[model samples]
Target: MQEDVLIEKIKKGHKQALRLVIEKYKHTVYQVVFGVLRDEKEAEDVAQETFIKMVDALPSYQQKGFKTWLSRIAFRTALDAKRKKQRQREALTEYAPSKEASKSAEDEWLQEEKSRAVTASIAKMPETYKGVVYAYYIEGKSYAAIASEHRLEEKTIEMRLYRARKWMKQHWKEDDF
Candidate 1:
């Protein structure tokens, strides 16, 4: 069917028209999202979301080039998914410790001791640095969250973390643990 005819049918709530639209443009939408996300699963998910958004926004859509508008939506949806995934990765890295596949009792004890020592070191830092360090490293809060919680700018939170690390390097000793 012609694009304009299909669109008109869709506007009138024709189910077959919606299905035909999906069949006609699904590959193009998937390719557009996949090009940006570079992950098959994520691309598929974002492409589905793109279609949903298109359906919701269709009533307001001008009769411009449909493919161009659809591709733009797909691109933005993929970028948003990519950014969300990145933030999740950063949070996981901040909170989770790297562990070997297997560990003996001695290794477990040593790990616990190291964790305790690190906690102690953080506790001993200056009051100004302590909150940012704990929120970021220990609590796994993002800079934006920490800044909002403390009513400070994100750059100030970053600067505080940098200074905190510098202070730790100056004051802490490996032998002390």
Candidate 2:
């Protein structure tokens, strides 16, 4: 019956009519998105997303100003895309440590967890094993050094550390480390 408007044609069947709508408004959509995004590739991408959004929103659209409504969709879609890009960029940009590299939150957390687990596990050892395990593993002392510190023979230090390892293997889960 020729409502004779682009939006009217689009609302009726929407396949080929949507194509006409896009062809008519593509430049406006691109400009609206580009005004906010300032990147040609991203603007183009957002313009496409904006069209899909417009078609989805067309059912809810009363016959108000079509161009204003369409531009608003383009603007909002661009901003949403921009915010998403910023978050992704922020996520990717981090972890590129500077020359004076420092530990990341994840690394620091894992180190602390490992240290605590080892210390707590060692604390559960018998008195005879506790000193040797702490000195050999936590303090990074050699068998001879631990023996000298404890005034025991080197073989005694080795035996105690071996026994401590066996105890830990039995008592702790495989993933404790």
Candidate 3:
């Protein structure tokens, strides 16, 4: 069957058209996903999802280069899956303690209390002031990057950082920090 005919059948909700679609493009889609995810099993899964999404979106298919469209779906699906996997892995690492687990609860409580006090101090700052401060210091964003991301002038970011530091010095304690 011609690719266009198969796509038309898919748009008409012919279930068997999905098989032909998958058979024709599975390897191409799988290669795109695997290039990003570097995992064969995950690539296979994303390839399947790409075909499913393509089938569901068939009505919108413009008969443009179908391979290009399918490859884009595969790439995006792989990227999304990679992000989810990364988040899960990061969560595990964030909760795992290399040494902190050996410390007493009182030690951890003291740390938490200090963090809370500093947070309260930060909360007292003006909203516009806090955003730049967090972006530059807490998030470690460069002035140029922060300016671009927030659509602010670089000098404005610098000024906010200066004020936020001064406010921190006046209101926050070293012990609490």
Candidate 4:
């Protein structure tokens, strides 16, 4: 069957056509995903996710280059998976100590207490600076990203964060955080 006919059939909710499309483009999808994610297991998983996404995305299938569209989906899926994995690794390392960190039990306890103190300090901040502080520090967002999300300028975010940190410092002792 021709690619166009198979796509039309998939868009019209024909399950068999969806299977055929998957079978036909499976190799291409796997290659694209694998190119982005070096791990074979993750590549396979992302390739499956790409096919699932392709089914939902087929309803918007007005483009002429079906292969290109599918490859784009595969590539994006792989990248998203890679980013998620990276974020997970970062989260794991953010709290736990490593040999290079050399933090002792006393230091770990102090760090936990400091974290709690910082949370309390943030809670006491004025509403204007509170949201930006949480987004930047806790959520790990860049100033530009926080600004875009709140529809404010990046400089405004920077100023607010700076003021918030100053407020925290003045309100608490030096060893608070």
In the range 26-62, model 2's lDDT, one tens digit per residue, is 9999999999999999899899999989878988998
Ranking by lDDT: 1, 4, 2, 3
Model 3 Cα lDDT, one tens digit per residue, 1-177:
888998888777788987887888888998999999998888888888888787777778799999999899889888999999999999999888878667899989987887677567667788987778767766788999999999989998888888878877887677656
Give, for candidate 2, the lowest lDDT window spanning 10 residues. Answer: 1-10
Task: List RMSD in Å for every model shown.
Answer: 12.5, 14.3, 13.4, 15.0
Tens-place lDDT per residue, model 4, 37-131, is 88999899899999999888888888689999999999999999999999999999897877747978998898789888877888888999989
Candidate 3's C-alpha runs over 4 A off are 103-177
Which candidate, 1 or 2, has the higher TM-score? 1
lDDT, each prediction: 0.92, 0.86, 0.84, 0.89
Error of 3 at 101 (Å): 2.2
73-115: candidate 1 lDDT, tens digit per residue: 8999999999999999999988786676467789989989988
TM-score of 4: 0.55
lDDT for model 2:
0.86
**lDDT head-to-head 1 vs 2, winner:** 1
